[model samples]
Target chain A: MILATSLAIAAMFAAGAYLMLKRDLIRLIAGMILIGNAANLFIMASGLRRGAAPILPLDEPTADPLVQAMVLTAIVISFATAALALALVYRVYISHYSVDLSRLSAAEEQQAERDEPMTEDLRESVRDDTDGEASPDGRHAREAAIR
Target chain B: MIAVPIAVLWFGGFVLAVLDGTRKPAAWLSVAVLTSAILSTMALGITVYQDGPMSLAVGGWSLGVGITLRVDMLSIVFALLSQGVLLAALIYEVVNGVGARIYPAVVLFMGLGLTGLVFTGDAFNFYVFFEISMISAYVLVSYGESPRQFRAAFVFITVNLLGSVFFLIGISAIYHTTGFLDMYRIRDQMPLVQENPAILSATIIFVAFSIKLGLFPFHFWLPAVYTGTRPSVAAILSGALANIGTYGLIRFGADIFPRELRQAAPVLIALGTASIIYGAIQALSRHATNEVLAYSAIGQVGYILIALGIGGPAGYAAAVLYTVLNSTNKALLFLSGSLRGWLAGAAFAIGAFSVAGVPPASGFLGKMALFQVGIAEDRPMLVALIFLGGALSFVYMFQLYRRRTAEIEAHGSSPWGAQVVVVMLALVILGIGVWPDPLLNLVERAALSLPEAQVP
Candidate 1:
């Protein structure tokens, strides 16, 4: 039974990793959810194989209360996290009109061009003197040289 | 009595911060509350040092059943480092009128959670407190006006939440095997789980914490999040929040896992070495000021883990000292750029020197001790790695310093208050380095108190 559980978790982890590597932000969030569930199941299987509940009668010795409490807390916290992640995804979708991370990167590149002058000012101040006098040539030269 | 007062101060401050608008009054209130809490914590720490570890059971329950707050030298030292740097940050924010009440509230709750995390005896309670701390951190990371912050917070929250779930599952499994939640109880009961099922559970727990600590491959979220957040918030998180990961690893890794598993210590050392190199390389490659500092933090955390993996009196002391010194220096550097003018720029230079493990600062002393430990263990490779790590740190930090200082020289002067705080932190960093006997002694005492492990 433990072996089966372990295999299942491994499979889920692989799926999660594949999805996470994709360029879509929504898929990445889904991948995170899958990975979290796999870890949760793996944790549960690490204990004794006995299927009995953790609660104990007055006469009977109790199973580990600590483990039960931890699992419950973990479930709640994960739920909250999922909600927050989805909210963020909604914001991303609204702004970029697509959940693809690659598309978002393209948008950022355009934004960077618009913001370049301010950065140039900062670069001028940062280099101060040595390269400061060579600004138009040096800054553009550096950028062009890099490309 | 100490626990009650500190809790009231922290929780109360948190509440006030939430209710108050993003105004100067709220910032002042946060400063006032945290200052008092720091004073009270210092008194408690001195008392613990003079006496020994102090414990208080919530609701007067017996140990191993009810939540217990244990105050020892180790907890006190972390608390002192966290509270002291946070206080400085609060002052900076107040003076700058970056007076967002939510930020202070999140910081206070983070502090509260950390205090409880360090002091709590019950394992389940630790998880509860960790969530409280993390949720607040999530909000804080996204609280700034920048869009990049929103993206960074989303990624960070997702990764950490997954880790937390794994942590919970591991805790449950341990309980099922041993029927215990208290760390001391679990330590005593570890014999029952010494075989396959129990050992596997322990491994899961370690992996969960490793992710949180940003160990090696698990560290992707850290640099982006740290760079994206406001400088003041970044300071508190790097200075205080990240330390929780290492502290958790130590509390669980040393106490719960079987001794044989610890034989894998060299693997952790290797990972630490890798992180050190990777983070430094990234920092050197970055031009964004915060990005550079963020990567530097990653490298410093790697150094801490390496010390802990060594697992001896000297190793433990080195870890603790490194934690304190690194946290302080990092906080100073992170906040320096936000200061008003040129003086702030100078402060950044001094802070960068301290962080790069230069002489006449606590970072140097801590690295020296860590190097000595590696040599004593006859691990010449690890020793060389430590030296390489130090040199890498210098390259990146000096690059940042030189870049920023030039900018300041070109621009106007920074506000006087910002300059003063930066200079003060630098002086303190230097003082600790020159006369480290007192701090070293404190760490020694704390390390000795930990229950001895049966080394394989």
Candidate 2:
């Protein structure tokens, strides 16, 4: 039983990690769920003991109930987290018309693009100064220099 | 008496959650709740200082069976710090008028969450309260309802969830090894555990917190979130939310896993050095106020890590003091940087100077504490690094201040109430720097709360 549970947890974690590497928002969320469940399973496995249920009258060695309670709490937290993630993804899709992480990054990339002209003008001026002081032909005058 | 702070926050948070936070009355009501929570926390702190750590078992269960609500000097200090920052940010947001309907309620819940997590003695309960705060933060990140904010929220949520998982795994491992869920019991049982599992769990917990702290290696999500969020949210993130990482590290590392912390000191110092240098360079290269401050936040946390690495009474005291002062500095900077007018600019300059470790600001004392630790430890390289980091910060902060001054006329003036909050925060920073002895003793006393780190 222990071997099976451990293998199952490892497999879930592996698949979850693989999915988390994808750019698709839905896939990323799926990966989150998978890994969350894996952690829950691992928690359960941590306190494994084959015995009677922990109930009122104790006549024998009982299985640890604490890990079970912890797993349940973790499950609820992750459920809420997944729900929040899904809502955020929907909001992103509404705003950007896409669920891809790369697509979401395009807006930021464009903002950076808007700042490029200033840097380019500075680089050109610096290169002009280098031509006067040292040699423009000098290698490594400024790696940022425009040709 | 033990549960008053959490009770006020939790009940207040729920009642406020149903109201429109954008309404003026609701906003002030939330403020009232937070103020009351702060007062109660201070009352608790007074009793704690007079006597000793106070504790309560929920439902009156025996030691290990039921969850514990522990209020030690360390937790009280953190609770006060978190609640104070939240109040400042809340009032600032309210004075500016909340844009979102849920802002005030979310901030209240964040207060409750921070207070709960710090006060809890059970590991699992800590995770539960940690989630409460993180979820509030997730909502807070997207407060502006813009594409930029949503994108930033996505990055923040995804990365931090992984950190949460790491923390959960570490807790489970600790339980498996120690056979106890309560922190005090776990601390007692930890040393008897085998070296391998103890070190493994400790390392996992360390990585989890370092991610939260946005140290050198795990800092990718920070700049995006801080830049995307509003100023009040940024202040809360750095000043209030980041305390989780600091407090968690001190509590779990120095308190529970002293041997492991001793073993990991070199790694902590190395990472701290890397974080300081990386953050400084990044801040220097950035032109945006939020971007520079984001990177600066990363840099400042490095000093706290270095202090933690030093260990013992002085090291722990230095870490606690630096965190408190750093929180105030960050809150003041974020709040003041967002406002316009000459007064706001002066406030920003004060924050900038404090960050740069100049005199008559709380930040200088934080630096002095770390420097004293280095001198006592006789590590000249550490001393040199602190000086170097301070020089780098000063240059970048001067650049930011000059830019703010130049752009003062470009934008319209902000609200006076908000500016007043910024100035008040600045005054607190200055006041602390002027009278460091009491704050120093408070932090030293807080550090002495740890079992092995008592000062002679």
Candidate 3:
């Protein structure tokens, strides 16, 4: 039983690592969920004895109920984190219209470009070059900001 | 008495979570909650410092069998550090303007988490509270609701969750080997356990904290998240959140795994050196304020690691002192980096000076502590490395100041309230630097909490 539990944990970790390396946002969350479960199982597997249930009227030696409680807590925490990750990924998808990390980081670079200047100096130069009406770049900037 | 801070945070955080914290009154309430927690922690610290360690078993369960909440000099110092930092960040954010509805509540939750983790004697409770803090941090990272923030959030969560899993594994391994989840009992049984398993779990736990600290090889996510978030969030991450790493390392390494720590001292020093050089060099090359500070954050933690690596009472004291100073400097820098006034510039300079280990700033005291350790240990090379690291930091901090000066000319000064907060943090650092005896005495006592650090 111990050997089988160890193998299962190993397989889950391996798969989690593989998925975590992928670019897809959902797959990364899936990877986190898997690794989190593996950790939970690892906690459960820490109980060495296979014995009767921990109850009010104990006839014999019981399994370690502490590990059971720990695994439950671990599951709740992991579930909360995974749910947050899903919500965050969905937000990213809606904003960039793609789930790829490359796209999200591309948005980051664009934001960097937008923030690079827009200071007094750059604003002065852009104002000097453009007419009073909205320039193409100005319109594009507004659209991007709204988006 | 030990549970006052934890209970206050619990009820306060629960009440604050439902309120819209972007409003003025709610934000002030959150600040009030954090302040009370800080006061209670300090009050507890006085008791712990004068008397000794205190423990409470929840539900009146037996000490070894039931969950335990323990407070000693070490835990109280950390609890106070985390609470004080959260208070500063919360006030800074409130004064500047809270952007999110949940910002204040999340900060309170994080305070609760840090408080709980440091005070818990049970390993599993530590994990639970650690996750609470990390979960709030995820929300804090995405504060801006921008695509950039989303990317940062994604990276931060994924990377840190992996670290958490590694920590969980280490705890389970400890339990499997020792049949105890209570840290005191585990420590008692650890020697009887075979060497190999203990070392493996120790290394895993170290890796977990190293990742959290953004130590050398695992620092890829740090700059991105630190730069991507707002200044206040960045401060909380570095100032309040990073304590988990420092406190965990000292708690787990020096207290729980002394043998493993001694065995790995050389490796810790090597890694510390790499982190220092790499962080300073990278920070020097970076142009943006946040980015440079991010890299500098990576570099400063190296000193803490080295102090922990040194492994004596003095070494442990140095680790505690430097961590306190480092977190304060980080809080001041990140908070002041966004402000525009001349006062903000002074605040930033004080933070930078502290980082570079200059006099009249708490950071200098931290550096001196390490220097004392180096001299006491009689490793001349270590002293030279400290000197070199300090020089490199001075260059980068000077460069950052020069750049900030240029920008200060272009922008008007910020609000007095915000500037006041920054200046207040600067004063704390300066106060400690000028009169280091109190903090020094406190840290020495905190060090003796660990069996290995018998200072004198």
Candidate 4:
């Protein structure tokens, strides 16, 4: 039973790692879920294969109580992590129109236009070339350049 | 009596903060609760110093069945350090008006979890407290409401959850093999299960803890997650949460699985050395203010792993001291970043120096002890790697300092609150560096309580 469980966990880990490497954010979340499950199985397998229940018994010796307690803790932490990841996914969808990484990079480039300078020195250079009044602000210059 | 008051204060404060809804009252309530917690922990420390270790069993179930809270020199010392760092974080938040009611509640709960983590003897109870600490941490990290924060918290939660699962699996396996939950009882039956099943269980446990500690190969998520969080959260996570991993390792790895750990020491040491170099290189290459500190923490934790891998009283003491110093200094650095708008960059630099083990700081003192332990263990190569790591820290911290100071000079001072915290934290760091005897003695006494390993 332990051997079978270990193999199942190994398979889960392999699949999770593959998904984690994918560029899509959703896939990454899936990967995390898989990995978390795999780890849970691995920890559960640590106890010897055929042990009594961890609860104390009047007639029989109790199973290892420490592991049972630790498992309970692990479960609670894992649940919280899953909830947080879901919220992050929602954030990604709202910010980027699309959750695609490549498209998001393109959006950032478009936003870079706001940082360009429009000063008197640059306006003077533009005026000498075109013999036209400078817009005083970079907006006209950028509009003209974009056009 | 002391424990009851502290515990009640912590739980009550948490409840009150949740009920108050208003930010100010919750913040003040949290501050009052935490202040008292700190005082109580100090009182406990003094009592422990005078009376030695003390234990109180809940509901009279004796040692094995009922939950037990034990305060030895070690638990008290860690509690004190945690309290001090939390207080600093609280002050920074209060001064900066980052004082959401939830922030204070999360902190109070985090403190409660940490305190409970140190004292609880029941394995299940340990998990309960750990979750209490970590769930609050998840909230705290994402408290900034920024996209970056959301992303970071997501990653942090994912990785840590996986680690917790591994921890659970390991614990369950141990239960199946041993039929006993108590550490004292587990030790007695250890010799019976020293074969294949135990070895496998030990390996699973190691992986779980290694991930938690952010050891090499498993530390990929740490730098990014830490860099993205708020400086206060980052400080607490780097300083306090990270130490829990090492503390768990010491408790489970050394105490519960001694023979297995001894057999696995070389691999553990190798990983430690790799992390030292890896984290240092990553930190040195980073130009981001927070990333530098994040990487530095990774490297510092590596040093603790090395100390644990060495497995002796001296090594254990060094590990304990490293935990204390690293957490405090890291908190100081991260908190300073939040307080000073102009010094964010400089605070990172100073933090890098403190964490990387540079001279005239607690980090340096901690590293010196770790290196001494390495030398005594005859691992000259490990010692060299540690020094090399320290050098990398110096380079990165200086680079960060120069960059930030130039920026500050260019922009002028931004805020006084941040500057004040930075100055105060720097003084604490320096004081600990120059006069570490008192702290070192506490760590040494704490280390003595662990069952002695026959030095191989």
Task: Tell me which residue pairs clash in candidate 1.
Answer: A67-B172, B340-B414, B341-B413, B341-B414, B342-B413, B342-B414
* Candidate 3 residue-wise lDDT, B151-206, digit = tens: 88888999999999999999999999988888999888888889999999999999
- Candidate 4 docking: what grade? acceptable
Candidate 1, superposed: residue stretches over 4 Å from native: A1-27, A30-67, A93-98, A105-147, B258-261, B453-456
User: Cα RMSD to native, each candidate?
Assistant: 6.4, 5.2, 9.0, 9.2
Runs with alpha carbons beyond 4 Å of true place in candidate 2: A1-4, A56-61, A113-147
Provide the lDDT at A62 for model 4.
52
Which candidate would rank higher by TM-score, 1 or 4? 1
Q: What is candidate 1's lDDT per residue for B316-342, written digit by digit as tens? A: 778888888888888888888666475
TM-score winner between candidates 1 and 3: 3
DockQ of each: 0.28, 0.46, 0.44, 0.26
Q: After superposition, how far is residue A137 of candidate 1 from its true place, in Å?
A: 25
For model 1 chain B, give the 10-residue run with minimal summed lDDT: B447-456
Please tell me what DockQ candidate 1 reaches: 0.28
DockQ: which candidate is best?
2
Q: Return the DockQ of model 3.
A: 0.44
Q: Is the docking of candidate 3 incorrect, acceptable, medium or high quality?
A: acceptable
Name every residue pair that clashes in candidate 2: none
